[model samples]
Target: MLLLNGDEVRKAFPVTEAYRVVAEVMRRYSAGDVVQPVRTVLGPGCDGSLFAAMPCHVTGESDSGYGLKAVLHAPGNTNRDLPTHVGVVVVFDPETGQPLAMMEGAAVTALRTAAASAVATDALALPDAGDLALIGAGTQARSHLLALREIRRLRRVRLWNRGNARAKEFLQWARTHTDIDIERMNSPAEALCGADLVCTTVDTTEPLVSAKDLAEGAHVNAVGSSVPGKRELSADAVASCSAFVDSREGAQRESSELAAPIEQGLLPADRPLPEIGEVLLGRHPGRSGTSERTLYKSLGMAAQDVASGFAIVQSAQRLGIGTMTDFTG
Candidate 1:
């Protein structure tokens, strides 16, 4: 078995390559080529934090392996100066059901999440999108900026965070690493206005972006609300836009951003909710009108982890990274 720590996994999965892998994953998903069971969670009390287990397998793809990931979310840890999220992924032999390797899940999660957003943007956003707005200055926010830059020729970036210090820090980092002009915004509305692509990565239960603030032909990717009762987009925001999700069932049950609007009749029940994969497969048209508003709500998925992990494992093997050991007893 091969054991890959977070650092090793990070080295193996480059942000640019992740975009390609995730785009292919979306195509497969739209074509119904993968099995992704809904992620199951437990906790908040006796178990210490919210815990989730996700399992997936790729159809007709040998050596890709069946993948299982266990994730724990401990928000209190942030206050204690520790990571709020932690987890691991186990890849198993397809024919024997034997464990083949163990890998860090946090890195996998971040890359897969950002890559999924890139796929959505590539499909839904205009080809000439140049200005980008990012809400929040955390790890996911950084990853989103990097992943999107690979797909678009971003010219300007507007950043907003509840903390001015964090926003300033991220601005400095962006200026040092990217040639794009970076500006700090005092409000979400100010940051969102006139932006071609808007990405929300903050953990906010209330609406942050509204319909009135968005411009025509804008594409919004809401990535923060992955569970019940947490919302970031207002009903007006959802109503004024054509929406798509990584998964329809996931958006219905887990995405408060989309669900809230659906419950209020802001969005039509008959409105076509196509999967990102379907868009990638060219089965459904994306961004039908150049002036239409489009939104992609991501709830995260295990199939993404499996597909991304497969990419990392292959890269690791080629580069001779990771610790290899025989787990056969």
Candidate 2:
């Protein structure tokens, strides 16, 4: 068994490499090459935090295997100097059922989530899109900024967080990571103003981005609030866009961004609007017009972590990065 920590996971899987694997994973999932169930989330209840078990199998690939990711979402972890997401992914040989590897999942989740959003944005956002608006000030927000840089040549960045001090702290953090000019905004609307690309990473139970505040032809990555109870985008914002999702089955039931409007019959409840995988596979044309709004509701999947974790372990092995423990017969 190979044990990898968060830093090792991030070191082995760069955003660009993560992007490549995620693009392949989504294509495989939507094409029926992978088998996974909707994750089972058990909440702390008192704090609305939850833990989940996501297991999946991937076939017809060099990394074919059964993968399991046990994840904990601790909303209060930031206050305790811990990651909001903490987990481990274990991969086993499909034929022999022998364990292959184990790696940290928080870094895997952050990079893969950001990469998935970048894939959608690259497919749907207008070719000329430049400016960026990042909502929320946590790990996802920071990772999205790094991942999106691979897709868009960002001209300006506007950031807004409910915690003004935290947003300012993120701004200072950004200064050390990249040379990009980022302005901390006072409000979500102010951050959204004239932004061509938007990534919402806030933890909210209600709508935050309004349709009226969105710029013409803007592309949105509705990333936070993965479960049924939490939401980030307004129903009007959902209605205004050509919506896309990571998984049709998962999004239809689990995406807070899409669930309400879909349940109210304002948006399609019978099926998801269309998947980013479909767009990636060229089964559908994304963004019908330059002036059209586009939204991608991202619900994190087990297959994503598994596929990404598998790739990360492979990368680490090639680089001799992790502790090689012997689980010998």
Candidate 3:
């Protein structure tokens, strides 16, 4: 077995490159070329923690193959000065089911998750889009800042968070790392106004974004709220947009971004919520008009982890990075 740590994973698969990788996976996914089961989430431990596993495989592609990601979400880790997302991704040979490599999952998850949003934004957002609104100041917000830059020439970034201290720290970090002008906002509405690309990365059950506040021709990447009962967008906000998902099945089962609205009779079940992959594969048109608001529901698919794992392993092999263990012995 091979081991690639967080540093290795980031070096091998940066967020900028991960966008291209995720886009390819999405394309294959829409064409019925991959096999991925619904992610199973268990827990609300005594401490309100979560454990989940995602498994996926490609059918014929020799490049992007098979893998599984085991993830743990510990909300209390913040107090312990550790990353909230703790996990590992295991790659396997599609033909033989042989263990190939294991890499740190946190870096992979952050990078690929944002990269997928960049892909969706690139496909769905207006070509001249520049402003970006990120509705969280956590890890995903930082990743999205880096990933979105590759897809759009961001002129300004609007950041909003419930904690001003966290927002201040996040802004300072972004200012030091990137040249984009970041404005720390006190309210979600203030952060959302006039932003062409919005990414809701907060963990919340209540809606933060409303349909009335959406900018004309804006595209939103609702990347947070992985649980079925949590929603970041208002039901009206979701119903008004041309909605897309990473996986329709995954969204229907794991995320309430779509399910909640449908269950409430807000969005028509027959309204054709095509997966983002369908647009990438040219099977469906994305963004019907310039003024249409588009929303991408990213539940973070297992296939994303599998594709990224394969990519990093391949890159690591060429770069002569990672530690190898003789599992055969």
Candidate 4:
């Protein structure tokens, strides 16, 4: 088995390359070429964080492979000055059923999650989008910024967080690290108003972006809520937008952004819903016009984990980066 640490994985899979790989994976998914089951969640309590397990198998295009990803979401870890997400991925050869690699899961998750958003944005967002809005200042928010930068020519970014200190810190970091103009907003409305692209990365039950604040040509990526009761987009926001999802089965049960509106009758049950894979496959149309509002809700997938794991493994081998060991018994 090849063992890959976080640093090694980072060196092997750059964000740009990860985005490309994820895009192709989504295209395959859209065309019904991959097998990805909805994630299974194991939670302890209402306040207790949950653990998720996702598994997938991909064969035909490359060496047949299967992978399992485990994620722990302990929000309270923030108080301990630790990351809220931690995980790992284990890959096995399809021909032998032998474990092939063990990889750092946190980095893989961040890259694939952001790359998934980029894929959706590439397919759904308007080509001329310039202004961007980000809700939350966590790792996912940072990843979103990096991923979108690769897909669009953003000129300005507006950031809003529940805490002013966090928002200011992120704004300062953006100014120091990126050339784009960064503004710290006092409210979600201020951050969203007139923005062409909006990314919601918070894990809150309340709606962050109001429907009235969203521009007509806006494209929103709601990445915060992957659980049943956690929602960040308002019913009005969801109802008024033409929405797409990474997976319909995942979104219907796991997406709080879609569930809120769905429960309120704002989102129609009969409306034609298309997966991101279908969009990538050209079976479903993306954004119709610049005036149309589009929303992409992602509930992170196992296929993404498997795809990214495979990429990291291939890149590591090419770069001669990891230690190979035997895990067959």
Number of the candidate with higher TM-score, 3 or 4: 3
Pick out the ten consecutive residues of candidate 1 with the lowest summed lDDT: 56-65
lDDT of 2 by residue, 280-318 (tens): 888888888989999989998787888887888889988
Query: TM-score of each candidate?
Result: 0.94, 0.95, 0.96, 0.94
**Per-residue C-alpha lDDT of model 4 across residues 76-108, encoded as one tens digit per residue:** 998998888888998887678888888989888
How many clashes in candidate 1?
1
lDDT of each: 0.85, 0.86, 0.88, 0.85
Candidate closer to the true structure by lDDT (higher is better), 2 or 3: 3
Return the lDDT, model 3, position 300.
88
Local accuracy of candidate 3 as per-residue lDDT tens digits, 69-121? 99998989989989888999999866677789999999899999999999999
For residues 1-329, could you state the per-residue lDDT of candidate 1 as single tens digits?
A: 88999889889999988888877777776677778878898875764578999998866453355898899888888779777789998888677887877898988888989989998999999999978989889878888998999999998888889987778788888889777778888999999999989999987788899998898999999998688777778989988988999988667767778767768987666667888888878788888889999999988888788877878888999999999888985
Candidate that scores best on lDDT: 3
Residue 34 accuracy (lDDT) in model 2: 85
RMSDs, each prediction? 1.8, 1.6, 1.5, 1.7
Candidate 1 — what's its lDDT?
0.85
Kindly report which residue stretches of model 2 are placed more than 4 angstroms away from their true locations once superposed.
none
How many clashes does the backbone of model 2 have? 0
